[model samples]
Target: MKLFVDCKKAGHLCDKGQYEDASFFEKLSVRMHVMMCKQCAKYSERNAKLTKLLKDSKCKQMPEECKKRIREELARELAKKPE
Candidate 1:
């Protein structure tokens, strides 16, 4: 199987817990490839730094009522059964 050009990109997507998350084995394979490739290692370092900066920045907070309503809507949605 082919490996991803940037293992950090795979890790970033994996962190999001999204439906499109890459498989652990696929990421492990990419990590292995990166270990042997200097260019990929630098790319991974840059991506990691960017991710840290983005996560560290402050953002606006939602109001308490809005947060509660959003939670209730999510709970109701989660309770629904799939066809």
Candidate 2:
């Protein structure tokens, strides 16, 4: 099952804080996997940085009007795209 838990999915789990609920065996498994997976370790670091950036700016609010306009533009762009 170790092969099933590749760095990508493990990184996703780590991002979602699944480590808190992981069993001792699972934790050891992930630890061992990450030790050899530089790509996953880098992914974890990027996730951490992004999470910190988002949390630190949690109070900064986007203007509703600006958001609406951006959404509308995105919708138009999406509509123009071919399936």
RMSD of each: 10.1, 6.3
lDDT of 1 by residue, 1-83 (tens): 55554555544543432333557666676577668777666765676677678778897789999999999999999999987
User: Model 1, poorest ten-residue lDDT window?
Assistant: 11-20
TM-score between model 2 and native? 0.49
Local accuracy of candidate 2 as per-residue lDDT tens digits, 1-83: 46447776677567555435555555666666678889877776776687778777857678999999999999999889587
Which candidate leads the pack in lDDT?
2
Question: What is the alpha-carbon lDDT of model 1 when measured against the actual structure?
Answer: 0.65
Q: What overall lDDT, based on C-alpha atoms, would model 2 receive against the true structure?
A: 0.70
**C-alpha lDDT (0 to 100) for residue 80 of candidate 2:** 100
Q: What number of backbone clashes does candidate 1 have, counting pairs of residues 3 or more apart or in separate chains?
A: 0
